[model samples]
Target chain A: MNVFVVGVGLIGGSFALDLKELNSNVIIHGIDINESHLQEAMELGVIDQKSSYENLSLADVVVISIPVNAANEVVPRVLDAVHEDAVVIDTGSTKAPLCELLVNHPKRRNFLAAHPIAGTEFSGPSAAHVGLYAGKTNIICEVEKTAFKLQERALKIFSDIGMRIRYMDPKSHDRHIAYVSHLSHISSFMLGKTVIEKERNERDIFDMAGSGFESTVRLAKSSPAMWTPIFQQNKENVLETLDEYISNLLLFKSYLEKDDFQAIFSAMESTNKIKEILNGIVVKPI
Target chain B: MNVFVVGVGLIGGSFALDLKELNSNVIIHGIDINESHLQEAMELGVIDQKSSYENLSLADVVVISIPVNAANEVVPRVLDAVHEDAVVIDTGSTKAPLCELLVNHPKRRNFLAAHPIAGTEFSGPSAAHVGLYAGKTNIICEVEKTAFKLQERALKIFSDIGMRIRYMDPKSHDRHIAYVSHLSHISSFMLGKTVIEKERNERDIFDMAGSGFESTVRLAKSSPAMWTPIFQQNKENVLETLDEYISNLLLFKSYLEKDDFQAIFSAMESTNKIKEILNGIVVKPI
Candidate 1:
């Protein structure tokens, strides 16, 4: 099987590597506008060949693994070039906008919209690894819209990469991911900003940042280029989630200011239930 | 040397274990208000003997490792009972209030107000482990108030346990800790609260939580009893930090709502500097 992957950065690069590792017969071609990333992907042996979009017509599979904004434009273009039998898939973070944009495409039946609930704060081709998708959930939106054979092909590929599949509407995917994924990125970035702005002393931040701070702020290191469009595409939902998040913080702060020890204690006590929720998720490093 | 540890939970239990691991001649006496924790501490052999308040005077050191509110009351009382040659220390998160309460104590010279920046999210004797303080910073505040001999004794113990020491005033310690530690707890607790309230389904939370959410929200599992007083005691600093944090989030939310991709992108781009600061701290599992 021949797979042509556009935007060979973290997710794309990892998918390329995993495909090669699992199926020796699979030949992977890398494509990226970032020349250095393409070179890095090839040099790192993430892909079998470096190719351009002009040759995407020959691919058995076409994966759009770019930023959400780029995916919005590029996925349709790739579909226009690929053969009728070729399967199309995307690993974009926000689903609704992309799904809405591609809803009426002539080859929409060949495209599968997916979000693998897996990632690290790190980016770039070098950050990619072979087992990135293993034991993680992959949400497929508008699955019924895709032709059965193409959907099966995508599912088989995901299964080979060791992912559990769950189906949902694009709208629902966007809403849930706002809370689960998007809100976390904003929370972490703002936390990093808060500490950096308030604690001007770099030495103090270094000396005092325990593992809790490290974990809490780790996502602040994510690529702004990749995330900017995700936040933009899922803007409304992300904003609502952020409002609720800020409100929660303000309420807790008031409890602290008023010396309402009982309220503060009970609030923290209630959140401890997250332990059980966390224990059930599969956590892996990037 | 004999060490009597009041409240042999996470912090105190670990200290006892480390002392025994380093010195065979060291005898540890365990004390806790919770009978189960005391029994578990004894079963784990964290101490040589389980003792009551009457035993406080027999020790060469009396370490108060209770909740912040309890430490304020208990440390003063423990100091009254300990031997003249003994060194007393408290490992509560907040120091300003405790230091103020004990500032004019007749035996203040025997009390070294120290805050060891070592802990996990989980609490109780079951969570204790050896070497929890290894290479971690131990902040000693108001050291000048401690008797020279007592300070010397405490430094030797900390050194033997493999800790790096830093000194600061209790007021400075509380302020910095509010940003680095207390605010993290509040952010995490609220992250958990907001997600739980929005999702309304624990199963969805378990399915969707990635490592980013888990890491950022890990501190939400911390013992409320341990954190409530820290917030109450350092209310001013916590409130200010919380206000700034909420403002940052709200600004980012507005950018998202307006689809201001550039503003959101730049905001996250700037906050990514936390990567460099967090590089200095060691992250240990709780």
Candidate 2:
């Protein structure tokens, strides 16, 4: 099978690595606007050949793993270029806009919208590695819109890469992901911003950052080029989550202001239930 | 050396383990209000014997690793019970109030106010480990107030456990910790609270919590009993940090509201500097 991967960065490069490991017969062709990333992916053997959208017709599968803003413009173009029998899948963080753009297209049945819920704080082809998607959750949105055979192929590929599939509407996927994933990145970035702004001495922060601070602020290291588009594309849901998060912070601040130790304790204690839920997210060791 | 450790929970129990490893000739005596913890500490060999305040005078060194609220009351009593040569070190998170309480005591020279910037989200004796303090930072506040011999003894013990010591005044310790440590806990707890409140289905949260979410909210699982007192004692500094943090959140929200992608990108880009600083915190493998 020939796989044409658009935007061959972290997600696409990782998928390429895992796909080849699953089936040696699989040949991955890379396409990216960035010439260096395409060269790196080829040098790293993430792809067997470099190809353009004009040659996408040769692919048995086309995976779009670009930034959401670029994905909105490119998904239709990829569908237009792929063969009728080829299955096109997108691995974008936000799904609603991409799904809406292709909902009524003639070749819509060939495209599947997927959000593979996995990644590291780092980005680019260099950060890509096999097993990134292993034992992770993948959300398939608007699955009913895809043809049966294409959906089956998508599921089989995900399973081969060790991902468990969950089905939901694109809107639902965006809404929930805003709270679970997107908001975390924003909060973490702002945390780093706040600390850096307030604590001028970088050495002091370095000296005092325990595992807790390191863990809490890890997401701040994420690529701005990749994330800015995500926040922009998922603006409404992200804003809603931010409002709730900000309000919670303010309420917590008020408790501190009133010296309401009991309220503060109760809030944290209630959130401790997250441990039980988090323990269930079994990430395969890298 | 006779070492007496009060409140044999995570910090105290781990200290006992590391202290024993560093000096096999040292004897650790455990005391706790909870009988179960006392018994468990002895059974785990975190302590060689059980002792009360009545026998504290026999201790050449006393380590008080209790919650900050309790330390306010118990630190003075521990000082009163110890001999002139004995050094009493309280490993509380906050330092200002505790230092104030012992400022004019006749045995002030015998007490050293220290905050070992080390801990995990989990608590209790079972969480204790031998290398918990290895490659960690220990902040000794008001070092000038401690007698020369006692200060040297405290530094030697911290160094033996593989911690680098930094000296700061009590007020500076409290202020800096509010930004670097306490603020992180609040942000993480509130993030957990916000998500749990919005995402009603526990299964959805469990399914979607990737490494990013897990890392960002890890501190939400910390012991409420332990953290509440620290926040209360450092109310002024914590409140000030919270205000600055909230204002930063609001500013970021404004950028999101206006669809200012450049501003959002730049904000996160600037905070990416934290990655460089965080890389310097070398956590030892236990």
Candidate 3:
């Protein structure tokens, strides 16, 4: 099997490594506009060779893992280059825009829209690892649009990487991810901004940041290059989640102002249910 | 040496274990308003014996690890019970109100306002473990007020627990923590609350919560009993931090609404500097 990976950065690079581990016959090809990333991926042995869109037809599988904005333009071109029996899939964070672009395409069945709910805050080819997707959730959107054999092959690849799969429509995928994933990045980025603006002394922040602060602010370290496009593509749902989040913060602030310790206590106690929900998530041990 | 811990919960219980690991001659006595916690500490071998406020005079060192509201009242009484040669230190998050309480006390020299900047979301004696303070920061406030001899004793204990110490005024301690610690907790709690309120399906939350969401919301699982008093005592600083955080969120929301992807990109890129600051934090590996 031949796999051609677009945007050979963290997700794509990691997919290359995991795929090679799953099948001895698998040959991975790297494709990235950034020449350095492609070179780094090859040096790191993440790919067996470098390939371009012109030769994408030779790939048994082509995975799109670029920033969502570029992905909007690139997914169609990759689909056009692939053969009828070949499968093309995306690991982008937002699905609706890309799904819309391919809705009426001639080779739409060759494409599968997937968002593997996995990643670290770090990026680049250097950040890729073999087990990055282990025990993580992989959301497949508009699965019924894909051909049956291609779906089976895609499922085999996801399973080989140790992912649990769920199916949802593109609209629902955008809404849910806006809450569960995209909003988290915004909250964390804003948190970092607020702290950096207020606490000018970086030494003070270093001395006082406990594990809780580190964990809460960890996502702020994520690459802006990858995330900005995701927020742009899913703006409506992201805005809705932000509205609810800001309102919740304001209500909690009012409780603080009123010195309503009871309300504050009850509010936090209610959110403690998140612990139970999080425990059920199959995230790999960090 | 005999150490009497006023609250045999997370902080106090963990401190007792670390202290015993440091000194073979050290004897720990558990004290808590809640009988189950006291009993649990004894069962967990976290303390040599169980004691009470009535027996506080027997302690050579009294560590007040209770909630801030309770600490303000309990510290004076514990100071009164102990001999002049003894030391009384607290591991509370807020320092200003407690420092104010002891400003004119007869035994002020024996009380050290210390906030060990370490903890996890879970609480109780069951959550206590040795090395919880290893490589973490311990903030000592109003150090000049502590008698020279007692200060040495308190420093020795903190050092024994593998902590790096920093001295600051109580006002500064509260203000710094309001940004680094208290605000993170509030953000996480509200994030959890907003998601839970919007996503009615628990299964969906379980399915979609990636490691980023888990990290951002981890502090929402913290005990309300422990945090409510910390926020209440540091209400002014907490409110100030909340105001800035909400303003930042509102600005980001406006950018999202306007579809200003460039501004959003720059904001996140700027905050990515937090990754450097966090890298300097010496968190002990779990």
**Model 3, range A1-286, lDDT digits (tens) per residue?**
9999998888999999999988899999999999999999999999999889999989899998999999989999999889999999999999999999889999999999999988779888999899999888899999999999999999999988988899999999999889999999999999999999987755665688898889999999999999999998999999999999999999999998999999999999999999888888847633
After superposition, the stretches of candidate 1 with alpha carbons farther than 4 Å from their true spots are: A284-286, B283-286
What TM value does chain A in model 3 reach? 0.97
- Give every collision pair in model 2: none
Give one digit per residue, the lDDT tens place, for model 1 in A80-116: 9989999989989989988889889999988999988
DockQ of each two-chain model: 0.76, 0.83, 0.87
**Winning model by TM-score:** 3
**lDDT (CA) per prediction:** 0.86, 0.90, 0.91
| DockQ of candidate 3 compared with the true complex | 0.87
Candidate 2 lDDT over residue span A1-286, tens digit each: 9999998888999999999999989999999999999999999888889999889989889988888999988989989898888999999999999899898899999999999998779888887898889889999998999999989988999998889888988898888899989999999998988889887754664687788999999999998988999999899999999999999999998898888889998999999998888888858742
Show model 3 residue runs off by greater than 4 Å: A284-286, B284-286
Classify candidate 3 by CAPRI docking class: high
lDDT per residue for candidate 1 within B47-161, as digits (tens), equals 7888998988898998889988888778888999998999998988888999999989999999998888887797888888998988888899999999999999999999988
Chain B TM, cand. 1? 0.97
Locate the minimum summed-lDDT window of 10 residues in model 3 chain A: A199-208
TM-score of model 1 vs. true structure: 0.97
- Output the worst ten-in-a-row residue range by lDDT, candidate 1 chain B: B277-286
lDDT of 1: 0.86
Error of 2 at A42 (Å): 2.3
Model 3 residue A69 CA deviation (Å) reads 0.7
Give the lDDT of residue B126 in candidate 2: 84
